[model samples]
Target: MFEPEKQLVGEWVLDVRPEEVRVLVSGFQSWSEAELRPLTDLQAVPMMKWRHEQGHDPAFLPSGEAGVWRSHTLLALVRPDGSGWVGCAVDAAHTFTHWEARVDGQQVRVTCTSEGPAVEVAWQDTADVIGTLETLSAQLGRNMNAITPTPLRVWCSWYSYYRDVTLENMLDNARLARQHSLPFDVFQLDDGFQADLGDWFEPSSHFGGHASELPAQLDALGFTPGIWLAPFLASPTSKLFRDHSDWMLRGEDGQPLPVGNNWGGPYYTLDTTHPEVLNWLRELSATVRGWGYTYLKLDFLYGAALPGVRHDPSIGRAQAYRNAMQALRDGAPDAFILACGAPLAGSIGLVDAMRTGPDVAPYWDEESRRVWLGDATGPSARNALHTALSRWYQHSWYQPDPDVAIVRRELSLLNHHERGSIAGMLDIIGGLRASSDPISMLDEEGLALLHRCLQISTPDRPTTLAQSFGGAVTHFSRGTFNLTNQSVTNLPAHAYLEQRL
Candidate 1:
């Protein structure tokens, strides 16, 4: 039991509720950066790569020295023998649970705050790290009863064509997919489809008034037509923004709250609490589904949950986000809702699949930290694998999408070993298998490699660290892989290793 009289640093106060005494744990190990590394202990390394993405789940970020660390919804501090405290807010549906940990040698102080609804943290003490996490995963899923959609091999157009994707590009890829006998169930048109972010009904000039026609064409060719859009976002130039300014979430200045910089400038969020905005979301989703596109890859969905003035102030951020997701579900009842860049706790049972990590780039590691300040939540294969492995237990909540595996040789910067490592990681931590390579550009070797990736059928299980050697090369079961560029060959089960790409 915690002795507040001796351990309390200062006065602990609650903003939403009156002060109440709750003593949870006692005798935590000396807190250091090494003590906090996600799955291993690297005492020599002072800094750790903590992930802070808008829609991604919060993973462990162990600090060697004293610093400020934060996690959303859940947090756990486990030792080599698996003795520690695991705390999670059961009321995440009503409010956002933010955890901040401050480490000082032997004593690690933690503070949890929520925007609304009184926080009720559920704490557990465990000697088995893996079992505790699995139990926690089931506990979170009790109310969700999430539906895992049928495993799908998908072909996407984003990585190859990006915003320059023309309808011709999609058709050509579809042809190659059929000719190569690729087992792709969904042919997803990512981004680039809408004339603007919020205006999903209008197609860009690249479609040539054939956006609706393309979906039917793909359907006739035995593909589930899919499309990507940021439904909660409205670009400044979008017709939706110009027509209904009142529908946008605003800041304290009474101006539209800018969510993030994208599409050449900043974009704003739609106030999901607004009755008309919810109606529009329902209508938008219905319209997209009506076009023979049953698979909806909703991207950049963090917009709806951003801090701003919502039309309804009684509910918190998580509730607001769930409300919007509910509207989309109501509209596209039968469509496959793949939630990308979405809040982990808020989207439970609402989406068929969830992107478990950040976007995967053609490269192995990210070079620059100037823009994102060393956050590992950016688009890199190494980044994706790190977070995905850390949160591998989430498969019970929904189908975990580890993002697309880029195996094709051409139009990519990844070398032989780098590409192979990506494929290996994706195969071991399986969920949705997707490729964005323009197949026609690939040679026989690349095509064969892509074929192998699509055929991998690994059972989803909790990835536990077997051992840790200064965070160098991490190993996994079914196959051994690495987090650092260092290579790791065949290793025994439950043997932890690390290697950088």
Candidate 2:
């Protein structure tokens, strides 16, 4: 509970509990004090008797079970002038968590630690009190739904040649996404779209010189047009590299520095410190915007800084992202930028979305194949839960994408039980992205599974039951319940959950 010593104009109470927390603000007529629930709760499957002990717990338990006995913390704010606004923050050090909440007379500016792993809630005079709160609730609720272990939004990325799929095939894929009632907002055309990686202009054979038309068609089909571009990257073979070699980040020997691992030859990083680089990026952004792309997934952003580079380390990683982000904003003012392979801290107040995990491969066998692969194993799942738990609070206009949904795959690749386990985990992460090819390939049962994953809402209660190297399980419950692990060899993991009926 928070009770300020000063004779403040208004009083705010912040209640933190093991399962959930609520914030009540008095003296404000617009928004009655409301309870903000954890988004991770929605992902918990039925379970009874779930609790965390100091030891002897299952190695990899769900969040609800793991976080039960964890210590929690809360921070609250008050407005002295009777302005009906307050600032609030909450964190659980056990999880290295932080979150920010803005209570405007009506709306609340709420960003959870689980969303960005950091919280920034401040009162802006020009803010919309009611709207902000509504948005906060909606965003938080979306995360809750994600954890509900149900799929809400079904999306796919257009990596063009990377996936060995074509533009026409992508259009067909869009139709299939809508067929499943999934709103495909981003039809991302990855690196292969441009004639050369550096020449941010001209379409390739894969796109058939109809890059602009592709997204427009997708929009007509009710999908948002999304394109992929590493604003800071330039292939040595690119025309831009030939013309602006000076703009590239140079090594100690004055040679262009290389960044990514998958790509064969060397690529240069943009010297964001140079005004020319910023100007060129802005023009490129405008060009992409002119091409009718509304969503931009900025990749390879971490390349901006290298270990022994001649860059300003004083401003730090966060500022470097800010510089690039500002350039992006100037380039496409209305574009939605989703940060990928970039540090989460640097993306605050800049990007509209972020990839919480690494790239997920289409294969189901190799652990290191995809970005979310680490999340598939018990230990990786625990790490993912902790990551999601730490960042949930930061979700707002900027959504935290835990990475792609790997549920639907060729039957030969994964079995039903394996699929169920993956499905259950996807619910925990919340936001999802799928490849273009798989969207069209899903069968009836597969589509149904995907839909079920989308519908689960965020849990009303947020708690961690147990965490271990094998895996961690968290639970969110609104009533008396019990959860047990049935991971006996050759048997499905089962949980028995009961409610007061």
Q: Quote each prediction's TM-score.
A: 0.83, 0.60
Model 2 scores a C-alpha lDDT of 0.46
Q: Encode model 2's per-residue lDDT on 182-272: one tens digit a residue.
A: 6545666666667767776766666556567776787788877887888888888788889988887655676766654335655667777
Which portions of model 2 show Cα errors greater than 4 Å?
1-154, 158-163, 311-317, 364-397, 431-437, 459-462, 469-501
Question: What's the lDDT for all of these models?
Answer: 0.65, 0.46
Highest TM-score against the true fold, candidate? 1
Off by over 4 Å in 1: 1-67, 370-372, 456-473, 487-501
lDDT of 1 by residue, 29-94 (tens): 001111124322211221222222132222223232324345566666655454555666564465
C-alpha positional error of residue 21 in candidate 2 after TM-score superposition, expressed in Å? 25
lDDT agreement of model 1 with the native:
0.65
